[model samples]
Target: MPVPTTRDKNPASILIEADKCSGCGLCVNVCKDFGLEIVNNKVHQSDKALFGCIACGHCMMVCPTDVIAIEGRTLSPVLMFELPEKSQAADYESLLAMFKRRRSIREFKNKAVEKEKIEKILEAAQTAPMGIPPSDVHVLVLENKKQVRLFAEDFSNYLKGLRWMSSRWFLALIRPFLKKENNEMMHDFVKPLFDVYVDDMDKGNNWINYDAPLAMYFYGSPYADPADPIIAATYAMLAGESLGLGTCMLGAVHPFIQNGKKASAFRERWGIKYPSREGLVVIFGYPAVHYQKGVKRTFAHIHRVS
Candidate 1:
């Protein structure tokens, strides 16, 4: 009787061609799960793997002879492609210039963003790295100003029900239970933010989404790493910048819509899959104003162990 491989039990599959394998040990060395080993002077799947094949494609991507192939679990060997020439890529100076050019644009022209540009931004963001093999990031796209305003209105109404969360009595009651930093943040930043959003909305001003022509909300599932959606949103922002679009990341919406029955219903209405640990809303449109200069930015502290 033959032993059942990981693929036999799961959807992930791997293929290795003995003739093409150079046995250079690159695949074996890079297989962190110990799924590959040298057997009979050739690279072969090892039975003593830690957790079986994860379909991460490390072996297939590293193999110079193209002897390995991985498929299933939303991945395939056909997805592999040759990287661009190194000389065509951006150098440090050019990359830094692009980074410095990015600004959080709030004032937008009264115009619509073309659907093709939005699609291109999404295409570029799709290349962002994920914490796992299959990405769990979800995006809610409000393609027009009306849709964005409608969402903002719905969110504002939802916030009314949870107003007590920011009340002084509520803060006093929860301060003892919360961590020191959390309690301080609740009193100092979160409470004021809630007030500003709700109050501004009541006065007929849409402070939530800023009436941008295109708004994208990136979120993650319960099992996802918190940084996954954030990184994806950042990528989308940069892609939008490259296409001559103004972009601003809205960080306030995610936390307010994360808990309670009302929040759940709001998420269901928008088709958000999970209460993500971290999320971001990026708004895109043509710029209405331009700045002549940008200020330098730096971290508050940096330390080197050496």
Candidate 2:
């Protein structure tokens, strides 16, 4: 279903042949502004938001089998955005308005998101594309904060004591002039969730992951290459954004889990097999804040040698 803008008017009467409809209700689900609804396993014209339909045609794209007809027939037809016969300043102005509207949100309202909504976001994540063809990747969705905390704590313990190598051995063997890295690394040593984003993680005050509501972990298989898990995790994050959810990538924990003695323990607790070193973790939550405006960015220079 395409959203009909001012330049593109909605056909007087668009018809959907119920007989061809699979009752998937993708049109209703995808077009939230249109207020389309699924009733009795069929799509019912929603009187609530019919006027707001932008006719973006997303509904037509999501339909699995041919079912919806825009104008009068059941066959998929070519829908085009009508351009003015003559150029006008208003057209470009409107286009810029739409382009400037999207912004990445960091803050979120205190309102708790429903579990069903979170599940929907996960469903979208599952649909994300993979880098390799049918590669081995495991996606773990941390639905609860406690689970995420446990994973973080377990990872933190794994990281403990390992810093002695970089702090003591490397410094002693290599150039003595190099600044003491152990102290800095230990200071930076975060107890997984406790240290990823939060500034304070002491017993009394804890702000790890900035009190995020959920986390998602991506684990690669032993048989797959190291980059496989990372690519999958990246896909999941993009999918999260499409669902209007906030995400943050947590990288430190994965390294600790792979090289430390606690690695086996963490793997057993999560019931996940230790893959290659490429395991990745990411946090997802309803943002505690929002950004109404986009920050300015520096332009990058590119050259094509060929």
lDDT for each candidate structure: 0.87, 0.57
Give candidate 1's total backbone clashes: 0
Clashing pairs in 1: none
Q: Which stretches of candidate 1 lie over 4 Å from their true place?
A: 1-11
Candidate 1 residue lDDT tens string, 50-75: 76676678889999999999877667
Deviation in Å, model 1, residue 28 alpha carbon: 1.7
- Residue-level lDDT for 230 in candidate 2: 78
TM-score of each: 0.93, 0.52
**Residue-by-residue lDDT tens digits, candidate 2, 158-264:** 44445444444554565455466744454355323334333233342323344456777777765555676776676666656655677767675565566545666
List ranges where model 2 is wrong by over 4 Å. Answer: 1-113, 163-170, 173-200, 204-208, 296-303
Number of the top lDDT candidate: 1
lDDT of 2 at 32: 54
